[model samples]
Target chain A: MTTPPETTTASTAPAPVLAPPRGTRLTLRDASIGRQGTPVLEGLALDIAPGEILTVVGPSGCGKSTLLRTLAGLLPPLAGEVDRDGIPITGPDAERALIFQDDALLPWRTLRANVELPLAIKGVGRRERRARAEGWLERVGLDGHGARLPHRVSGGQRQRVQLARALAGEPRAVLMDEPFGALDAQTRAGMQQLLAEVLRGTGATVVFVTHDVDEALFLGDRVALLGTGTGRVPHVLDVPRPRDRTAHDDPATVELRRTVLTSLGT
Target chain B: MTVRHLLRLLSLVAALGLWQLLTAFDVSVWLRFEQFPTVVDVAREFGERVGSEAYWQDLTDSLSRIVTGFVLAAVAGVAAGTAIARSRLAADLLGPVLEVLRPIPAIALVPVAILLFPSNEQGIVFITFTAAFFPVMVSTRHAVRALTPVWEEAVRTMGGGRWRVLGSVVLPGALPGILGGLSVGIGVSWICVISAEMISGEYGVGYRTWQDYTVVDYPGVLVGMVTIGALGWLTSTAVEVLGRRVTRWLPRTESRAEAPAPRRSPSWGRSLAGAADPGPLTSTKEA
Candidate 1:
């Protein structure tokens, strides 16, 4: 992989196109994670390949979010190590972006401004920032609504802007905490499809946490089933056919889906 | 005009008519309406005062004091509040001192203002500043503290530093609450400034009103009262209007009521086109 020279000073990059971000290999080794001082999920061993989508589904109190937070470096691991591409994760980096379920778009900003936030933080110039933000907004199918505030747009549209904002940073890994869990069934499906569509060619690692079983099976290259309790190793399963909504009835897919449901004990 | 607007106007007219009737006929039903100035007498006094130089000087003096004090309070209060709320060190240093001082009535500081400042003008301004400062500080502190943590996190994950998070998220997020404090602060400043003027002022509407009372010019006193009322209303309205304009991004339910209905029925076609209906999006659900 040829890495571009670090542009410490602002560069007037002509085109809005960014070099496809290289994905980070995330590894969790017997890591204990939780909020404050207490551990919620413990003794976990997992290796997520670069450029893979890993959907985590579990019971409500299973600490799926805690695990994601630890990976994002928002929370420190209680024990063991969490690494990104062989380096220990100590703090949140721009290379690892987190998307929330609440559609955490700043309510005060216009959709375009919201998308431009990460870029602005990166010290991108005004012209490049606007061009890139508009590009991302268009990519999310929210081209004309850039001028509207977050409250003016539909919940799904806001989620799309959130997605655009997350992607606009061109993070090597995207940690999503039930990002589409608030949407209606149809909108959720539409968003899921849109997620798959937009994620193409970006090469960003995605760790998606959700409660929906079918959603896990559909979008994930691999599904990690996290059972409740301390010192539990999550059961990981690989989907035979990923990103195909019609593969629900496939025999192997059906078997795996049943296993996930049974292991989750729902 | 709209019926609501007309009704508001009618309400004000009715109030004036009742006052006029009570004073014109000298109907003293428990409250001494007989001794009070008649509506025509007060109106004539107001006309005379408006044309006089002394009245305008009083008006300008009071206004300048309020304006100077309120502006200083807004700047200092927001800074101090933001610091106290955002930093543990600042909170520990200043919180207790401010809390102890906050409870004393700002107008009651008239003696302190008179003793501390070299001039009555400076003293009155100090009282006005004191009155407005606490409200703005307390509201701003609450506003800064109440900001959602996700915004800070979002900024941090984007590689923003401490100052970056403050400038980008904390200030704008707390702005609505700060503006609320400002509106209340302006009103409180008016109250205390007028009272301060009454106590020690040489040339202000409050001082002039007390002077009118001493000489038994009931109509002139009523004019002073009316001038103070009009000025207070105008200033407060100005603050409120400015607040609304700055926080225009806030979701307004009233705007939704006036929006045109969605041209097409809820269909998958619009969804596919990613152009969902503009109706309250919350009401739309896929069955």
Candidate 2:
């Protein structure tokens, strides 16, 4: 069932006054991704339209992370290719950003500096990059914490810093590998809500990988459930409107959550 | 002021007291207790020589050799280690040679060093370099290899090329290990420089100790020993302080743990600082 990508209004936070540039379409062409000659995901074909959030849910070893890494161009596919805007992804590019679970903020940099890394790598001018980094940090609710080291902040706060870093580059696509997995449930919920708010009108396509079904349904326009036995995605559940937490308690979402849970076998 | 400090002072006093009693009472004629200098005599000699120009010259000579050798070893070791860890070609070419050379003690190479270099100073410096090089190299390699793959991947995914990845991720990620190597290298370099001086060259703390031994100047030997120990302590302290400064972004707790109160210095504490990733020869290499 086709749904309008941009027309869905948020039931919680108000949409941003001006929408950011929409993300480029990302597609996998019969891609087979793996580690060291062993295929983890084989013969997979999926299209992620621009300006949408796609969440991947699977059991621990079902290669959810492998799938994200492949998209980020960090890992080579075993058989096929991942393409962005119809061009093969040769390697990592500035247009796509990956958010790691460990909040891989350079242990040598302050929060502002970590957020500034991608811009610096892109050869952005000093003052402009710093301003953008600061803006992103403030948007992520880390206004005064920019000078703090990553280790000095809590796991939830570090996750926010990571999100700021990912978005600061104004990437067309963001691949998150359990970005909030290390945080507690309360913090995870808060981060998920914040993510939904900040990303609502930004139009940056996001592929979020998580084992939690509720998180998958709450934040994704489509929830992709990967079966343990099959290396490919078995199901992609579309929600009428994502970013609607009240929908989470509705009978329809509850049934969909059950379906995702059954697919995950937990 | 602290219990630890009190215990350390008491331990030192007890050691000196035992030595003084042994010499005073002449506990065993066969043990050469009579030939041993008393604590008071050694202390007086230490006091007398502490301000002497000859002692100062020896101190400067030894300090210069250790600092030069240690700095050279640190720079070369980190470069070589990065190359070896990051490139298969470098590892293949240099790995076996370094492995073979690493085991031979720098002291054992003193004669060979003298033959190879133009002057005794260069020869002594060469020995110290050899002593410092292996530990720094091995530790840095371990640090580089043990770096979390995510750090590099993060940089790469952000459009950082090879050199950017090396500068942004590899160097900083490997720093704790490099610092570990430096601290150990400084200590080892001191040992080697002094030993090389005593064995081959002139005008160093080790040489002075050896000279005193030859001339049967017993108290003078103690003075030289104390001087060498203090110099080694100061140099290692400087390295540790620098290490802490460079890694300031680390959590306060982790950084604070790296530099413990120098008074209660335990060998394992140093190892603990670098224990996040245990290199192959971590335990044995420090010596």
Q: How much of the true A–B contact set does each candidate keep?
A: 0.36, 0.42
Q: Candidate 2's fnat?
A: 0.42
Quality of candidate 2 docking, DockQ:
0.25
lDDT string for model 1 (A1-266, tens) is 37655532214222223553378789999999999889998899999988999999999899998988899898999999898876789998898899988748888888889999999999999889989999998787777567767776677788888899999999989999999898889888888988988888799999999999999998899999999999899999997654487776888888888899999887
Candidate 2, pairs of clashing residues: none
Looking at model 2 chain A, report the run of 10 residues with the lowest lDDT sum. A8-17
TM-score of each: 0.88, 0.85
Worst 10 residues of 2 chain B by lDDT: B278-287
Query: Model 2, which residues run further than 4 Å from truth?
Result: A1-22, A125-127, A230-234, A258-266, B1-11, B17-28, B252-287
Task: Give the worst 10-residue stretch by lDDT in candidate 1 chain B.
Answer: B278-287
Query: Once model 1 is optimally superposed onto the true structure by TM-score, how far is the C-alpha of residue B120 displaced, in angstroms?
Result: 2.4
RMSD of 1: 5.5
Model 2 lDDT tens row, B1-287: 99999999999999999999998787885677877788899999998897788988888988898888888888899999999999999999999999999999988998798789999999988889889999999999999999989888888888889999999899988998899999888888988888888888689899999999999999898888888889989999999998988876665554444353322211111211121212121111100
| Candidate achieving the largest lDDT | 1
lDDT of each: 0.87, 0.82
